[model samples]
Target: MDSNKNTAVISVIGKDRVGIIAGVATLLSQNDININDISQTILDGIFTMIMMVDLKDNVIENSDIVEKLNALGEELGVTITIQHTDLFDRMHRI
Candidate 1:
């Protein structure tokens, strides 16, 4: 997943419903971001997804991506969080 470039982990959480994936994927697609890894599932009707995306030279900054994602979240009635890969990994690693 282009180890030499910077990446980020994006997560979305909310009630399960249609277009969750499409909404998020559409934003990413429009921004020219590449999805490195993704997994999603429904737990008791709550939708959750984690995506590792490559952001190097994506025509947008980290903050810009976060802003757009947050907007999408608002429209989709979800909560979204975007974090740098290194920061996320370090913070989550035991």
Candidate 2:
């Protein structure tokens, strides 16, 4: 991962199912977003994931990604959200 690249946090939550990661990854790859780190787990029957992605090389606008992700989430029966790393940090800061 390139440390200097702009980054964003992507979160996915929904019922456990196949292809959640694959779907999200494929979309990101198509947009030139690079995954820097990922963590996922199943709590009971729910699936949750957090992905840190490098967006400096992305070819599309962030708003477009958000729209695409929202569509994908509907298709996959999951909720997907993205936020810039800085804003995410600030929102959660104590």
Candidate 3:
């Protein structure tokens, strides 16, 4: 099996604030999800982050993460979106 087949893409976007990265990282850490790559930036006071994470060791399903992230996003006042890496690629392919 491809090692990255279990990978996922997590996206966060909202007004800049403290603890966005920390919150997401903490959740993933507690769930045994490892971050493979991450890129974040602030644009005109808006915060944007893209994280490529490995779910091979994760104990939860992708739907579970989506729910958890949605709740976290509400608390943090941001929008969180997650998709399997394969699905992401398929949707983005032109």
Candidate 4:
């Protein structure tokens, strides 16, 4: 198995609705990002997803990914955050 140390975490949170997965997955796929792991669920009609994506050798840069993801967020009415594994680990560590 591949290590997730270099992967990025993308979190999406918004009202439950259609096309959330499609929109996010499409952007990642278009950028050649590989989805290492994904988990999603609905809580009180709000949808939330955490995706671990591998972007080691993709055409898109980190800034570009942020821009694209922001665009998707705006379009979907969701709040999206993207973070590097190291930063995320540090921030979320117990």
Model 2, residue 28: distance off in Å is 0.2
lDDT top scorer: 2
User: What lDDT tens digits, residue by residue, belong to model 2 across residues 26-72?
Assistant: 99998888999999998988999999998875633534999999999
Off by over 4 Å in 4: 1-4, 58-62
lDDT of 1 by residue, 1-94 (tens): 3245578788999997789888898888888888899999989888999999888675345348778888899999999888777775566775
The CA lDDT at 45 in model 2 is: 84
The order of the candidates by lDDT, greatest first, is 2, 3, 4, 1
The lDDT of each candidate is: 0.82, 0.87, 0.86, 0.83
Clash list (residue pairs), candidate 2: none
lDDT tens digits by residue: candidate 3, 1-94: 2235788899999998889999999998877789999999989998999999998756346347778999999999999988778876776775
Lowest lDDT 10-residue stretch of candidate 4: 55-64
TM-score of each: 0.83, 0.85, 0.84, 0.83
What lDDT score is found at residue 30 in candidate 2?
Answer: 88
